[model samples]
Target: MESYTGKSIFQKVAVGRIFYYEKNENIVKRNRIEETEGEIKRFEAAKLVALGQLDRIYQKALKEVGEDNAAVFEVHKMMMEDEDYLESIHSMVREQKVNAEYAVAMTGDNFAKMFSQMDDEYMKARAADVKDISERLVSVLLGNGTDMGALKEPVILVADDLAPSETVQLDKSKILAFVTRYGSSNSHTAILARTMNIPAVIGVDISKEWNGKMAAVDGYTGTVYIEPDFDCMERMKNRIAEDEKKRQLMQELKGKETVTKAGRKIHLYANIGNVADTVSALQNDAEGIGLFRSEFLYLEAKDFPSEEEQFQAYKTVAESMGGKKVIIRTLDIGADKQVDYFNLDKEDNPAMGYRAIRICLSQPEIFRTQLRAILRASSFGNISIMFPMIISVKEVREAKRILEEVKEELKEKEVPYQDVETGIMIETPAAVFESGELAKEVDFFSIGTNDLTQYTLAIDRQNPKLDHIYDPHHPAVLKAIKMVVDNAHEHGAWVGICGELGADLTLTKTFVEMGLDELSVSPSFVLPVRNEICNL
Candidate 1:
């Protein structure tokens, strides 16, 4: 018998396949009708029906966000009214002389193809929306409803990416886990997965070939097992048991300070999006809110929110946290989050393009609006303003100048506000290299490991082919993080982390050893990570 016993410990596991929509498949029997170079009332009626259905769904989702965050819905409304898209659809129908049913189908099929060719994952996923929207219109033309009830139950959802609509409509209670073929770590689906505390693996191979077989999904390792034998099943079972036990033990550490076994105190913080998310953070007994992304403020508004409107939004969160630290990041929008109303142009590589501090510098008015709101709310509780994608000292000085201007304006107007601390996200390679110098100017530092890892490694996070090259555990990445923390501390500033890696179980000890001041992760991970820190 051949002996096959000597082997290294397993580095990673493959448990599933990612499924992407086959958008290239040609539509059959696409009936073409002769056109008369004019708008057809029948096609217009079908478009109206589709828009109306979208409106109903939008209103329902808006209520969950409240009046403050309802601006995002307004953008969706505008998207439906995009004149170019409407014109294209009309041209296709009039020239092809097809019925409204076939017209909608062809348009959807064609749009999906166009979207898939884009470099952005967000735009690519938007292709699915095009397909879905057109299909619904076709259903209306056919005198039928798009029934999702036929969706198979108790099966893992596989897709190139999942949109907010698909995620919200899914029977959350029945989903075991979802795997996507493509998406950034901060993509909407990944954010929803963390918010929902569901196990999910993105940018992986997910297919139906393993139907009727148990596939062990390891969200932490980003792997899936297909048709595992008895031994593999037992090993995965043991791993699951261990994970559960760890979680149970971590629950006991809730509401307690994360003091290490060696008497080192580490702050545990929550990374939240909007005010609605603060409830979960507090429920988890977090020390404070470390990274409160302010992009949502700009995303949901019909227009630029008045300072007062922005103030109230910030005030709600401050009051909820009382005296706890709330590090609110300034508007971080740019290339990817294209708000056409703002006249922001789409870029080939938005991540590396003009965004964050760059946008704020160009449009001081927008930055001032957010800064004024944050400063006004500061009086209510602890609040800090953090600038993202900080690469130059000039941007820092300019941002500070704007804040000062806001303060002076508020003072002249006799508005009540508190003086606040300012900080920068040390995510770029340049920022890390200059931490020693930059630390002297900022109140503190928050290491955004996601971008830091990507930029430092010179890898596009969305590229699965280069996934092997993107390593947060590599010696170089670890050294960069340590350099930032050490330099920040040396300059008399504290440093915290607001990246996904901050929540990793294995890295907790490494961070503790490095003497990190705080860890801000998803609210659900607070208890477990704090527990790990406490027992360190």
Candidate 2:
């Protein structure tokens, strides 16, 4: 191999390393059947040490960052201590008489092989789970930590996979982009990465082939280019300059009203999860908090949070916004995001079955607790309650009934409260059809286009086979959105959209044309969206 040249003409090569966890682990050659008991014990000892290290890391994060900020580390801690995973490792060691290293190495190799062979993109990305666990194990075993100091300059981080803890600890300013060998655009890491407004690429293959190769990744276009010819690099440079110019202009527009270049008024808002997210929203110059998904209150707790707990969480977000409108969706949990506390009954078609309002109706106590919490929080700042997945006027009436009941209870307890505006999310076609009727009862309406598209098209957005049918721009989806907006407006209720479709530049004008009063999207989209709105 005196003269070896192996390269592809691809524009961008993903970066990763060929990590071999099997190295130094006494793996008897497959052909040799030597005793592996001692090696197995050593592997088990390594596993124990790794798990213990995870606990220490979790504690360190908890001490460095508050409990809420260290949620990712907490999740990792739970995963490491999960009985099933621990039992699996112990069982493998006992059954095979091999050490923990061999078990983990074989598990990683097998999973990588299985995922690599899978045709489904979503499932294939799960191979990153294997990579994640293996990476942590390797990191603990060899103590070969990739010092964060090496990335002194602001540049993109290209890797095979990134744990949530890693993402949380990353210095956002130094990271311009995040490209991974395996991930979906909808994955949690991608979600957080998007919030940081750093360009990211996921599901990239052959990342290890590009080690030490300088490349530029365009997260917007999902493109990566290795050492490119001057022409391409020049083009990229010009694009970057243009982008910077546009960004500077947008920065100047911050704190100004979201009015179109034509002087037409449009509302710009942030869709946030918790109090921490409101910080990003305000930073992006969001006029208001349009969609405060209430699921986080449920997800981050060991049990159902008490009404007081929920109230404080809601109040924190509302008070943080300082009178900015915050539309809190009521307990939008079921089906897709089942909570440990609220265990939904398995359904043949969960997407169409008991979810959101359906689940709330069956468990009014839970719904009442949340309603009570929202009302109490309302005393602190501007907050509106939006009932998710309401398909009929009946659900609206029932929710309002529960609200009044909570009001009476609060009054009886002499607790301070505020009168909150009630709204419903028009996400199902049935709900869109009845928007006029629902709007008459509700104070406002928010179109949840994500679910509307899936329900109208009868396609599971997460299903790989039907992902194409999950188009939000389908004419039918547009019609549903238009109908809901018109109905809500005709009924003298403000209508807005809190969906991925809202912030997309391609559809922003279409939404404007459709008469969407407010568009709530991820904070990262705020600047670009505002720029687009100004030019509109």
Candidate 3:
């Protein structure tokens, strides 16, 4: 019985035969083509094919996982169609007289390297995005295809790493689980595995000879047992049964109201990044969407998302929610969520530097464009606009002024829209202290506990070295949350928490006792949280 231990990304269990996926690194040798135009045409043709395949994958993922998760393909499609990216590929093919695959490989490497050097976390992560798209294009150019049709049984897949494109292309029905040799908690494979509710272990190395061997993967302990004895297999089967039983029980709690024992009903909502997430949000029985990270549209786009582009995305999600509240937070790009096209200046300390509301306030037209889109989408269903990183009442008033101006413009242009409620995120210590004054300026307050905790504790949440120091339940962070909740109530404004802390089951009772009116977490947490509230 061969055994290996690695990092467990999610605690779950699965047992099945293993299928190793060692992707052959296709090396496209430099070949001088006779016709530049022909190579360009070939590249364009491959691009079209890749886009079509991505669109199909996007649709499948939308139904299987949800919209926000499916949006990864949308980002890929946009990247493939990006003018700058296309120009680089075209120039390479024409000038270098190289084959389509070589041109794409070279261009992708150049762009990815540029992104990898950026200080922002999101920008740095985009290096992976470029690589994914490039590999897709190359596969299309080479006309390579996946042939797993002969496998009549489901199996746990072991791969070096699974790119987003490859992950989406996988036959989920045949996938028992994912065991990768290399990946981190935030890697695309880990993210997809969690989205699909599949158990996963990463950063483990096993002999290549283990392929096709029966194995048991223990996600909780991060162990992979190859050719386990019959006794070990029995234990895995029992664990799977226990997990299934818990899932069945969870399903029974789906329609249960999230009312406390004291008869206080707190709204349970979902935080989504895109339209795709609404499907899962609804499936998990989320009453509404509390935090829509509007920056996703900006990040997915090659440049600034036009008003109409933003309007379509917002409208799709709003209409899909069937009039349930959807609070769209206006572009929050900065401090780890930077977009390359924005050309935002590098800062010594991005977290405290120009970000969120500061960028929106400085770039009024950008703010106006998003406000116009959100307002226009409000006509389709229940919608509200929220601003992030707001540390002052002055910024709230200024944002409202611009919003009112956009309303008038839309009114004059005869564009119909709902009178969308506006709100601010109480994320900073300054906002906590000034909550009373700030609450009066907005319709509601949504405590962004991720930033709130970080700011209150003076720690960067993204730093792996600071993991031990970061505590969301710290007295200072809790005090800030209680202050925001209390002051908002005092000002006749309700408060909701739409951050990581909102999803912490251990603190659910404390939050409910503190008078938080709503808790917005990820889709998967809605039912579990609802169950917790009922127990309270």
Model 2 spans > 4 angstroms off = 1-174, 181-184, 227-237, 261-263, 345-348
Q: What is the TM-score of each candidate against the true structure?
A: 0.71, 0.71, 0.76
lDDT-superior candidate, 1 or 2: 1
Q: How do the residues 163-240 of candidate 2 rate in per-residue lDDT, one tens digit apiece?
A: 443443456666666666654445455666767665666666534555455566654456666655566567667777
Q: Please name the candidate that would achieve the greatest lDDT relative to the true structure.
A: 3
Error of 1 at 477 (Å): 1.9
**Cα deviation of 496, candidate 3, in Å:** 1.4
> Which lDDT values do the candidates have, in the order given?
0.73, 0.71, 0.85
- Superposed model 3: Cα runs more than 4 Å off: 16-24, 27-99, 102-196, 201-214
lDDT of 2: 0.71
lDDT of 3 by residue, 1-536 (tens): 98999888777899999988764556677889989998888787667657756765775586579888988888998899889999998988888788889989998999999999999998999999999999988876765543343457999888876655456457777888889886666566775676567889987895678789999999889999999999989989999999899888888888778898888999999999778889989999999999999987886665788999999999999999999999999989987665657777656578999899899999898999999999999999999999999999999999999999999999999999998888999899999999999988888999998889889899876554575677888998998888888999999899999987898899999999899999999888898899899988
For candidate 3, the per-residue lDDT at 206 reads: 58
Q: Evaluate model 1: give its lDDT.
A: 0.73
Steric overlap count per candidate:
15, 7, 4
